[model samples]
Target chain A: MQSQSDNEYGIQVYNASINPAPRCPCVLLLDTSHSMSGEPIAELNEGVKTYFEEIRQDDFSRFSVETAVIAFGASDQGVSLVMPFTSCARVEEVQPPRFKAGGLTPMGQALERGLDLLKKRKREYRAKGIAYYQPWMVLMTDGAPTDQWREAAQNVQNEARNRKLVFLGVGVGPYVDMPTLTEICPDNRPPKRLQGLRFCQFFEWLSQSMAAVSRSSVGEQSVRLPNIDGWACVEA
Target chain B: MGKVIYSFGRFFGQAIGHVKAHCPAPGKDRPWCDQATADQMRGARSKTRSEPQLVFDRNGIERRLGPLMAKGGEGKVYPLADHQDVLVKIYHVRARNGDRLQTKLEAMRQMRPMLNSPLFGWPRLLVFDEAGTWRGYAMRRLAGVQMQTLCQPQLIAERLPHWSRREILKCARSFVSLVGKAHRNQVIIGDINPGNLLVDPQTCEVRGIDCDSYQIAGTTGLHTCPVGVPMLMAPELLGRDYSRVRRTFEQELFSVAIMLFRMFMLGLHPYSRTYGEDPVANLKSGHCAFGLGAGCRLPRGPWYKIWSHLPFRLKDLFIRTFRDGHGDPAARTLLEEWNDALDEYLERLNKGWFDPHLVPSAPKSSHYRGSDSGRRKGTASQGSRLFRKNA
Candidate 1:
C-alpha cells in the first residue's frame, strides 16, 4: 500500500533498498572562488559538506538524490566536473567530497557546468527507465561575477520562466544586490539572502524538499516546505 | 470583529507565501538557467540517443546455459554465437552491482607473469565491454568438461582402472605445467579446484576457466561465490585478508595442491560441504563439511604422503597451505612437491611403462571435409565435437 508520505518523495529508501524514480536532478553551484576565502568560504564549504552528509542520512533522499558540486573559484576559466553522484554505489560510499579553495569566483562558468552535469545524470536516469521531477540549480555566491555574469543571469530567468528548472539564488556575505539577483527570475522575490553561516541549514532544507518531492509518484508535488526561519528569512 | 485585526494572520501568511513563490535574489542568472538548461538538455538527448544495443537476450541466456552445466555461483553462462563457440558470461543482476569494472580492470592488469615465461593453457581475453549498461564479457569457450565431473574418482575407477598409475601422473603433470603457465603469465587462478579446470578426455589436454575471479598482483582480490568448495580456496582468500598477497606464489601453489589432491586421490574434495539445506550457508561457515577420506591415509615414501616426504622447508609450505589456505589464506603457498611429483609422473608416462593395462586403441574416425578457403579449418573439429557433446 502506498502511504501519502511515502508517495511524496521521488525516491524511497527503506532497509537499504533504494528505489529511485527519474524525478529530478539537483546541482549545487558553489562559490569556491578567491573572494570567498577565510570565514565566509569556510562556512560556505562547511555548508556544502553538510548538504551532502545530511542528504545521505535521510532514508528517501539517499536513494534519489544525485548531487553534484560545481566549484568556480581557483579555476575561474570554466566549471569542471567534481563528482557524478550516480557512481555512489552505496550509502556508505557517499561522503562529503572535499574541495580546495583559492580562485576567482567564476559564477557564470559554474552555472554553465552545473547545468551540463545535471543533464548528463538525468539522461542516465531516463535510460534506466526512471522518472524525474524538475531539475534544480541552487546558486550560492557572495559577490558579482568577476567574469561576464549578466548572460548567465539571463539564462537562469529563461530557464525559470520555461519551468525547465527551479532556480534558487542565494547571496551570502556583503555586496549582494537583491534586485539584480531577483531579475534572474521571471517570478518576483526570487532572490534570498543568507542569514548567517546558515547556508548549511538552507542546504538541509533543500535536501529535505528534494527528498519529499521524489517520494511521491510522478506528477505529485511537495507542498509546505519547512519554514525558512533563522536560517533564511524570506527576502523582503 | 475589526477587519484589520481578524485578517492579520491570514494577511501575513499570504504575504510570506507570495514572497516564497518568487525566485530568491540572483546576480548571475545568465548561464545559470538558460545556458545550464541548454547544455544539460543537449547532453541528455545525445546520451539517450546513443544507448547501446543488447547483443544477447538477457532472459534467454540463463535458460540455454541452465544452472551451471556444473556447480557455480548465481550468474549463468550463455552462448553468444555459434561461430566457433563464443561464450558470453552474464553476471547476475545482484552481483552486477558489485565493483565489476574495478574487478575486470584488476583481472586484466594482474594477469602478468612475474618471471616472463610462457603460460601453459590460459585463454585469451576476447572482449571486455563495460560501456554497455549490463555487465558482460565474451571469451572463447575452452574445450572440455569441468575437471570435477570429468575426474570423478568413481567414474575414473570404472572407465580407466586398467590404466597404469604412470598414465595418471602425466595427466597430473600437465595440470602442474598449466599452473606454471598461469603463474608465468602473472595470473593467479584464484580458484584452482577441479570444478574450474577443464580437460579434453581424448587429448588429455587441460585449460583453466572462470577468469573473472582471477585478480592481479598487489591486489588482495579473492573470489566470492556461493560456498560449498572452500577446501580448494586458500584460507586467506576465504577470509579475503590482504596480507595473503604476500604469499602470492605459495598461495597459488596451495591451489595446485588441492587440484592435485582431487585428481590423484580420485575426486575427494580436500574438504567436503555439509550437505546443508543452503550451500551458501555452509560455505559461509568456512569449515570442512566431511572428514578426510581414505586415500590420504598412506604413510611415507608414497607421494600421497608427499607432505611428510617433502623437505623441511617445502614440507612447511604444504602444511601451511593445506592447513591455513582456507581460514588463513595468507599462510599458504604452492609447495615444491607439485613440480617434483609432476616431473616424475610425466617421465614415466612418456616411457611406455604407463600404457601396459590398456587394450590397443581403435583407429579414430576420419574427420568430415569441407572447402578450406574461408572457414576455420581446425575450429570445426573442436566446435562440432563440443556442440555434439553438449547436444
Candidate 2:
C-alpha cells in the first residue's frame, strides 16, 4: 500500500487533477452481445487499443480527455463498467479482461449505465468547480437491444439534441438495428455504418475528432473534424 | 530509454545538452529533441519506410529529410539528411493559419543572427519545395524533453529521475532568463506554455521551441502570435482574436507568473479547484486558486506546503499577481522583479535555509523569518503512500 503522502490525491486522482486544463469526458458504450462473438469482438478490442493510442498522440487530447468503457452483454445485470473514467495522460491496463463476448444484448440498460455515469461525472465536475467541454458518448453496436430501452433511448436523444452531449452511434455489422441506434442519436449527427470490420479506422477517426474538439479555444464554435471518408459510411 | 547518448548543441558560447530520441524505428507514440545517434540509424530506417521525403532549402536547393524526429497536430519535425546539426519543422497542410505562418516566419527570419542562441531554436534558414513554394525552416535541433513532461510526477519520475525542487527552481529561472532575453530583443513569446519550452534534465538548461508563434515587432508590421494555449493566456487575451489584439510585455509577465506557479505547485493551474473549474473560465471570472479572498481552496496535492515554503517576497508577488493583477496587466510583477526574487530564493536554498523538499512537509505552525529560517529537514518519508516514486 503506497502512502498518500507523496501525492495526496493518489495516483489516479492526481493524474486527473494535476492538469487543470478543462476536462473532456468520453464514454464508450459497447455492444458485447453473443452476435458479436467471433471476428467482430476481436476487431472491437483492437479498435479500442487503437483509439487509446490515437488519443494519447495528441497533446491537448491527452491532457483533457477522460474516458470510460461500459459494455452490455455478459454481466447478469446486463451492464459492466469494464474501465472506470481515467485521464488519458496516465491510461494503463492496455489489455486484460480480454472482452469475452457472451449473453444477450441489453443495449438499453447499458445506455442507462453510460448516461448515469456521465451525469454523475459532470455533477462531480460542477461541484468541484472543474470546467468541462460538452461530454461525448459513443455507442457501437451489432445487434438489437433485448431489454426495455425506450426511456433510456429517449434520454440519449434529448441530451444529444440539446447539445449537452456529442453522441456518435455506429453500427458494427449488418445485423445492427440502425433505425434503433439512429433513434437514440440526434438527426444532425446520425448513425454511421462501419465499413466492413474496419474498427481500427473508425477508432482513428473518433480519436481525431476528439482531439479536434479538445484543441478548440474558449468561445470558439464547434470544431469541424477531419473527414470520415476513411472508415465511416454515413447514410444519406 | 536505454544506452543513452548525450549530444551537445552549441548555444551562443555555452553547451546545451540533449538526449538522443532513442527511435530504434520511428513508431507512433514517441519522437523528439535529438536524433537516434546519427546517419547510421537513417540508412537502416529509410529502406523500411516509404519513399525518401524531400524539401527545398532557402537557396532552392532540394534535400531529402531523414527519419522523423517528432510529429504534432500542427506539423512534423524531421532531421535533414545533409545537415547533421539541423532539423526542419514542416507545418501541417491543414494549419488553417498557413498564410499567417509564412508571413510570421519570414518576418522572424530577419532576426536569425541576433536570436542565434540554440536556446530559442530560432529559425536558421527558410526551406521550400522544388516548386519554390515555402515548406518550413531549418533550425538547430534542441536537446531535452518538454518542460511540461516535468510538471507531472509520473512523467518526471520517468524522464528526470533524480530531480528535486531545486532543479524545478533552476529550470524556472533559466526559463525566465530566456524570456527576459527575448523581451530585450523586442520578441514576445506570446504562447507561453510548458509544451513550448524544452528542458535538458542533465544541465537543467531550457530551450524555447515553436519560434513561429512568437509575436515579433518586425520592421514591416507587428507580426502577431495567433496561436495560444487558453489556460496559459493572461486574462486580457482570453477569448480575443490573438491576431488582432497586441500582446504587451505586461501580458507576457502574467503568463510568466502562471508558468512559475505551475512549476512550483506540481502543475496545478492557479485558477484550478481541487476538482476544479477549468483555468480558462476561472481566469475569466478573476477566481485564482491562490491569493487571499480568491475563495479558492489549495489543491489536495503538495500545493499548500509548497506555497507556504516559497519565500514571502515571491509569495507576495504571486498573491498580488493572481488577485489584483488579473485585470490590470501593468499591475503584474516585472520580469526583473522575478529574477531578483529567484536569486534570493536560490541563494537562501544554497545556504541551507528553509525546507527544500520536493514534497516538503508542513510543520505545526510558527513565525516565518524568510529564507534565513534554514528549516530544511533532510528528505524524509512524509507522504509517500500510493505515489511510490520508483527511485
Chain A TM-score values for every predicted structure, listed in order: 0.81, 0.89
The candidate 2 chain B region of ten consecutive residues with least summed lDDT is B378-387
**Candidate 1 per-residue lDDT over residues A1-236, each given as its tens digit:** 44534323111222221132223578778777666677877677677677777566543455556777677775545466666654222556666656666777677777767766766765654343334567778887777776676776777767767766778888887776566666654574377888866877787678657655544323323233445664775655
Docking class of 1: incorrect
Instruction: For model 1, report DockQ.
Output: 0.01
Q: How much does candidate 2 score in TM-score? A: 0.82
Q: Write the per-residue lDDT of candidate 2 for residues B1-391, one digit (tens) a residue.
A: 1211111123211212232332222323333333222212221221123433887655455667877765555766787775545677787667736666777776776674435565787765667777877767766666567776665665664445566767888988898888988998899999998878888766788889888888898766888887787778888887789878789999999999989888877666777764545567778888766654444454444555566666667777886788789888778988888999998888887776655666565531344444433342211121112012211
Which candidate ranks first by lDDT, i.e. highest?
2
DockQ of each: 0.01, 0.31
RMSD of each: 30.2, 7.7
Report the lDDT of model 1 for residue B72: 21
Model 2 in CAPRI terms: which quality?
acceptable
C-alpha lDDT (0 to 100) for residue B209 of candidate 2: 84
